[model samples]
Target: MPDGTELIVTRSPPVNSNGVITLTNRHLPQLKWQESLLIARPVNQFRDFFPEVNNQNLTEIAIEIKETYNDYLKSARSLEDLKNRHPELREPYIEVTSAKSQRTIYLTRLDRFGTLESVFFSQDKQFPVDLQLVNNKIDREIPNSLLAVATLDLEGKSVEQPIGAIALSSVEEYNLKAGINM
Candidate 1:
């Protein structure tokens, strides 16, 4: 998936120190050289440091990271838009900013009641608020219990991941419950 950017993935082989594995290297030659050095140092000098390396988990880690970025981007955009609409209250609300291809996104949550309610995101802009575009993949990925709102700004040219989260609560006037302010 390297349209213009280069992507490199390399895996190292597991090393055997005596009857146990000490460390696994991602680069084959580097691991080999380390193994040789360990052998020369002593017969089983590294045997006591036997630790199993889960090489198979690397791909899973990358996939999870990619998903996280995607989710953050979507959330940020929506938050930015919400802020734009309520310009006066922008300072009161918490903000989480994330970046996509070129734009920066802000995610925030506003509490209205005792129960957790809805989440909001911002569209990158100044005047009118733009809601985040919904991606089918992201929609499917989220749990059914929660709803997501996002906004995207293609005109922006920043590339920093937004770092914030929102907790929502439903507003129920009929229910006599005072919210705990922290």
Candidate 2:
């Protein structure tokens, strides 16, 4: 905001733990150390709160991001189609992103009514350097529909599970339904 670019800072869009970033509408809590905002729009990607840009670094980053997104989309589509034909797969799944070495994987499974599960993890040697095992297993159902993000700490090979979920009803059903006039 030092550049004097006014940010609406609305509460509807819901920010993530990384704080209110415009592009990632993850409605997680704002931790004390996170600067990522709780609101986002398409332009949030270009909002550089770091420092002045000199070369085409920003452009390059954006290009790589697009490529990554496309790769994920293609993979997800393929997985969905496979799941459709083989309905007995039970819980069909897809791993969204992975590092070059296959040491890390981001996973999501396809569900009925266009719903999908969420998964996230960060890897580091310092993350419980002695951690020999991780039991990343989840299987639960909420009778009342609600939105929730599960948080886990890979450090020390333990996790602090999420307590509750936010409400499902919202003003914005369709993307861009929240008028720009606001």
Residue 142: error of model 2 in Å? 27
lDDT of each: 0.36, 0.38
lDDT tens readout by residue for model 1, 77-96 = 78777655544336334332
Model 1 CA lDDT for position 160: 23
Displacement of residue 110 (Cα, Å) in model 2 is 18
Q: Give the root-mean-square deviation of each candidate in angstroms.
A: 22.9, 23.5
lDDT by residue (1-182, candidate 2, tens digit) is: 99999989667754445645553444335434647753324645666774566669877897798788778878877877856644433343322221233332222333431224323323222222111112222334532132223334576665543322221221122122211111
Residue 64: error of model 1 in Å?
0.8
Candidate 2 to truth, TM:
0.23
Residue-pair clashes per prediction, in order, are: 21, 8
Error of 2 at 60 (Å): 1.2
